[model samples]
Target: MSQAMRSEVAESWHRSAAAGVDVGAESSPITLPEDDLVEYRAAHALAPVYPLLDDALGEAARACDALLALSDHQGQLLWVTGTTQTLRRAEAIGFVEGASWDERLAGTNAPGTSLVLDRPTMVVGAEHYRESVRPWNCAAAPIHDPITGRILGVLDVTGGPDVASPQTMAMVRTAARLAESELTRLGGPIPVPHMIDGEVFVRADVTVQCLGRREAVLTVRGKAQVLSRRHSEILALLATSPRGLAGDELALLLYEGDVPATSTLRAEMNRLRGLLGEEVIGSRPYRLLVPVAGDWNLVRALLAAGDVVAAMRHYAGPVLPHSDAPGVVALRENLHGELRATIVASDQADLMAAWTRASWGADDYEVWTAQRDLLPATSPLQPLVRSQLARLDLEFA
Candidate 1:
């Protein structure tokens, strides 16, 4: 209510939160892996008409400093093309071939929400459900089978704020209708676009470095500044809450002793607003006005891409190691555990050694064992590893 969010968008946000989508998720999941993607795409109902769709939207998207994307009825991105600069930037959010734009998984987005509502739609900055995607704006319209009228896919134009205009949505809708007419002219049972089967983010304005520090170091507009512990905690809570939090909920997470008055939480928020500026925060259910990210985002992104070495390089200790706030504790442990699991699975001696040398990893029994198994008898790390293993055995005993 601090800002005017469209009713359709507001409803989508509530549905997204209800579905348990992660607000910090970096990108759409790649539902169409390489295995059958080529074959499936070649035979898809929308496949034959894609060239026409591209021609209709490609020039306009490029002119607008944006990319033209096509997604299946279930919201899997099948094609994404545009100028090299725009494509490169779009890659930061995995806005490429084979990624799913499903609302339940990727949250409220142009491609996903258009399919959900089965109509032309646009999503602008800060209206997005996930933080990493809040910087960009997009407009999309559903492509349908002319005979049956069931949705076949989505046609979208994604770029900066300029893409959110009514004109852009109208263009996309027109392009989609052209594709549908082409499909009608071609004429046949498309069949698989909707009925066939199942299953399954990047740059932000505000960056908060919550890892390896008690209080967060927030960087905005190219200046790095540290926030008070209270402010940092508030930021952390708001950053993670998918739908934002109510006043009473925030109070419960913040206080440890006897519950304080709601006025106390409001007073703290007032001070926080003064420090961070009013534009960065929202009310009703307290939320962030801009897309937010933490340092840990880099490490997880690397890990997910199968780059264990790069992931290890960016793993900068635990998140807010000293904070006892329930939400912070959960995120801290979950991130640490996820990273540790990925490291152990990699089974690379150098990677394990790198982790074992870190203070937090020194006491890790699983990693030490994995490292020991990978090392040779003459390895220089042998003696140190042996001593640590012995110390760990006795320490545990």
Candidate 2:
């Protein structure tokens, strides 16, 4: 779209917000660069969280707190923090649930606008495109997954016109950091074992586990306990990564601390297969029994919780030999790239939150370091990371 046309559209959007009309249907008269904006608005109108998020939003609303609401990468509004009254208004204005904060939809505001600018921002009064919202001011920052570099969503604070102060924005930023800290905790992938019922915990059956506080392993028909040490290791590794390992790669990983000969490796795999049975084992490359995806694991559960850091803990070790295999190695690297990309795209607060957790040697320190190396020194996460490393050094010494 042309600059003049874009400006016109932006102005129209603001007008629509002022008029308290449905912007999604009329936002077309105003035009801009992002086609996805309309789509986002329609999608965002849906509620992302129900009664659970209502509690936080309710608290903020009740307290008449200055607050912000956030969404996930898919643009699902996942969290709301700050004043109870403002949160209620935000929810009433359709900030709850599957809302899209991407710039194309909500013009210059905390959630949608910040995602577009890819930076922190404050949208006050006329700056907002919607008419009914013209009286409010909002500030926002974007959050990202440390490894994936994918924008998780915008962290925003919204309130009455007067409440939109620098102090309020600072408070919103702090809340955003807490949310991002939860994201940091989800950075790693971990094994989640399922509890088996009356069934046998034997070698032939594939086992899936529950990762909750009461942990247990289960199978299709019954409980199983026939897995050998190496088999158990393989299960645990795949459980963590959710990506299967090849025979040679698994061999290398199995021999990491104790180097086993290739033949021994083959024997161990054969024994593992014998226990798993041919039915559970799939085709070539990933010839192991029980496909990795079959396991729900802790990481998957954590991801569902909106905590990216917890999901990351399941990575176990570097695939197999942590080498460059198509299965384990490739997935590991993919996750690493995801982390870097997501972190790169995140707002300063989000990046620092991630750095704070990772730099402290939370998951695999070496892996965390490798990911950190990808960022430039000027990156917002740099200072926090350096501080954390310094603290770690002091603590270890």
Candidate 3:
């Protein structure tokens, strides 16, 4: 290795050793059990990108005697694909699914170091912190969610020292981009609003639906997990508070009148930790450690951008209709009022007509009246709009 390259590896090795990674260890740590591994992969939203990644790097693996691997942001190997001989070689080195390859577990290596550095990295033979893995070389790049700009995982090509070439690094980087592009195509465009100083914003892994009965469908990397009602409220509160909330503050936000016992809250959070992984929620001032895409936030951003139509599409319903928690109630009314006002204030007859027909707006007398007035006498919608207005008038009377 070049002197500069040796210095880089040495620095990483020092850090790994400090983190209690055993340099002389024979194998990486197995932090995930078989069942948990299945759940982890299933919950990861990036699973959809595997096929694209394989397609992009499969031929290279076949020709170069290399293995194409994908690991979650935590450095756990999610999938490994390559020739039978290469697979056998990787298995001998304990490079298999469910293995924790993070630098703290596996010592200095391409995938783990790339994650820590948040950049592309190459580790050649003898550069690996563990002597057991010193025979193999790997190049890896981090893949990020295009919508939220969150690191989803790493894409790597592993083989002999020949795989450490500039060309191999470029291939891994390109494959990472290809996977990200596929993710972007699937998620559609989510406009991130510009933030001024003192303003707080949070991104979500999935859209939180608080309308009616509170529920959240958490999608990370493409894997979806429908959160329980309590989990939905907990996530919603934390996702909105960028600086996080203390135990007392969170309890007040989650409960009404008498706050729940601290033990109850702790137990709930513990269960949530298991489902979301330990890295998602933090202690002390509890907060979401990752970006989340809440439907409420999307609506607010869309409305701010003057895209009322798009905002309406994202408005599933009121935010947590059953929750009487002060914060949640305030958020619910604010969003509901803003959206209704935007629709009523809009001059577009088509938009008013569209809103009046939706489940949320079906009973909106103002929108129905506006639609009635805007439609021509010969228009079929005029009759329906007028009838809706008359019915609303009778109910109010």
Candidate 4:
């Protein structure tokens, strides 16, 4: 189907689902779960994780006179802003990072419905599925990235349940537009786009700025870093590969049919290492800098896609920030294969073990659940997983 038609169907689904919530009114609100590991893990691992955009545009979203930013895609509230009263009301109605708003999970509401509809939307109180959601006026507008024009997220403004003001709707749209503008400004036209794994960087004039698939950078400071043609080409190559390249591999990628000497390739690596630093390359495996963790471009995609094999394959090595040698390419390939195979072989029981073994603060129920769901039933995992999940139910309950 055409993109437009599909989008229409999605929006229709949202509107019908949110039919009864009393959105724009003043009333006592509901309770939300405290910020905890379950909430953080789910939010952190969900598809379209917007840390980059959130970090960049949070201040503006908060400062907007009548706007709040939220993620409809994941059925979580994401972020909220505007007057203190409005925020309190929104929070009470279960619009937070960890709360589920899917019509399937939590009944009808703004975010889940908006995502189902794939369009901007407004949802009022009793229009909500749960009676607890009967107070609050919420209007939201979808925001898109200028480059790819994909729906990045929705901007929302919620107020007193009884308030039916048109200004609220207008304000939500305005905030969404402002957010779109900021996204564009943050990602500007670039002569050289840096592609270090998925940490894509676009040089404006002098300083290098990072970019993602959907957002733009427009600030003057971001525009100052202009990169050379070769640099841009090199960055792009590293960004797409499943494994890191050695000096010869990088040289082959950059040089193509031509055969560059080992020494010549070493010179380029040294120069790149000097400029980008040891953090971009690493002593182990002598690989290029391609961040596998934190807020990099591929991370959100990996989370959303929910393909652990692909994700593990992408993590070819410890994000080597400096080394590049011909011999290192083999090691990079081996690690990629190892990680993918390991994740593929893991079951829910193994996943819980992995989570248990992770750093104390990083053990997340979301990740544990996700890993569990992905395991094949025949993979010698079900019995052990059942036992662990049973234990978890008792512990959390």
Best by lDDT: 1
lDDT of each: 0.78, 0.46, 0.76, 0.45
Error of 2 at 82 (Å): 7.3
By lDDT: ranked, best first:
1, 3, 2, 4
Instruction: Return the TM-score for each candidate structure.
Output: 0.49, 0.34, 0.50, 0.36
**Model 2 per-residue lDDT tens digits across residues 253-369:** 545455667678666656756666666554345454453332333334444454443343332322223233233344445455454444334332333233334332253344345
**Residue ranges of candidate 4 with Cα displaced over 4 Å:** 1-69, 82-91, 161-163, 188-304, 307-397
Of 2 and 4, which scores higher on lDDT? 2
- Number of the top-ranking candidate, with TM-score as the measure: 3
Please provide the root mean square deviation of candidate 1 (C-alpha atoms, Å): 18.1
Model 1 worst lDDT window (10 residues): 193-202
lDDT of 4 by residue, 145-238 (tens): 4443334456555545323366666655666666656556656222111221122222222221222111112122222333343453454445
Over the stretch 190-299, how does candidate 3's per-residue lDDT look in tens digits?
32223311112345554455555556667776677788878888888887898999998999888888887999889989999899888888989888887766768867
lDDT of 1 by residue, 116-213 (tens): 67679998889998988999999999986554344678999999977878889888989988897787677632555323332101345577878789
RMSD of each: 18.1, 15.7, 22.2, 14.3
